[model samples]
Target: MLNCLIIDDEPLALQLLEDFVSKTPYLRLAGKFEEPLQALQVLKEQPIDLLFLDIRMPDISGIDFYRSLPYKPEVIFTTAYSEFAINGFELKAMDYLLKPISYEKFLTACNRVNDFLAARQLKEKKEKDYFFINVSHKMHKIFFDDILYLEGYKDYTKVHLSGSPNPLLILHNLKYFEDLLEDKEFIRIHRSYIVSLRKLNTISRKAVSIGNLQLPVSDNYRDGFFALIGEHAK
Candidate 1:
């Protein structure tokens, strides 16, 4: 299911979108907010897949709001003006709907969003299954399931395998590995550490244990780390 949120200052517009979203079987309405800042807070607290955003609002422009987000969801701009259409497309929005949006148009936009997500999921599945990295002038195929954890320092990241005593050091930052292994069962608990969720033996608020290694969970990534592990536990 696509978890969606609506952010429009107009009360009537919000109600209309809410009604339309409720009728759609695949789109689940996670929230509706008149204030963009409040919506941003809710976004941090929950997982949102799609956004129905208004272009012009009292607090901030929808374009700016979307740009400010660290992790952007698929967006469908809803505005009374047509001038913002070009800007919306530049942001790679799923669709742009004029005010007084019809159920037909809304449904069409929803279908596009569904198609985009499906394609992305299929691509991520292939990436997560296996990947190759250049180490010691050799390209090594590393399966996601065989990885235990990774440690990063400077521009080099060491990939630790399940049973290997020596790790493969690749000239890549932690952020590179984080994005590469995002869809796999791996969680970055600290700036220097990304551990395989499948290999985790125990977890606490401040730390996680993988085999005999106990890694610290930094304050910056603690909430997201815990959330990911909690989902894995289920």
Candidate 2:
């Protein structure tokens, strides 16, 4: 089942989307929020597969809010204005749904999401130590052992390698890489970093060292990271 969230300022719109999610067998409603910021923690802590985002809002536009997210999910933009469709598609949104959405349109979007996720899960389940990343519009194979660390810069991540002098930059968030590398030989040491377990040269209470490079371990991820490395931070 695809877990979903709805963010709309209008009570009626929220209720409408909530009803649609409830009626769909494959879609589960994770939460609904009037303020986009209210859902930030939920987004971090829970697994959300899809989001129904309202385009216009008081403080933050839906487009901006989606861009700001560290963890991005498949999104369907719902708006009263047709002009916002291009912006939504530019951000790689699954669908652009106009306001006053009928059940038919909603179901169509849900069907597309289901199909896309089906393919993605299949791709992920493949047994391999290396995964392919899109680089310059082409799929580039990256092996887990070659990775030294990962650096995050907003929506972009830098894949540092053992032999390569320069890191490979990809259009993916740190959180995305964290999830992608889950159950693998990787541990997130900071909001902006993830390091290979086999590549870590040294570990301290507030930082880790790899290949002569030092990466700070933030307070948030300190304990979990230490435990993973089998160290007791003082």
- Listed in order, each prediction's TM-score against the native is 0.57, 0.55
Worst 10 residues of 1 by lDDT: 121-130
| Model 1 Cα lDDT, one tens digit per residue, 1-234 | 999999999999999999999999999999999988889777998899999999999889999999999999999999999999999999999999998899999999999999999999878676657889899999999999999999999899999998798999999999999998877878898999999988989888899888888989999999898887678669
Query: Would you list the clashing residue pairs of candidate 1?
Result: none
lDDT of each: 0.92, 0.92
Candidate 1 local accuracy as lDDT? 0.92
Model 2 earns a TM-score of 0.55
- Number of backbone clashes in candidate 2: 0
How much is the lDDT of residue 195 in candidate 1?
A: 94
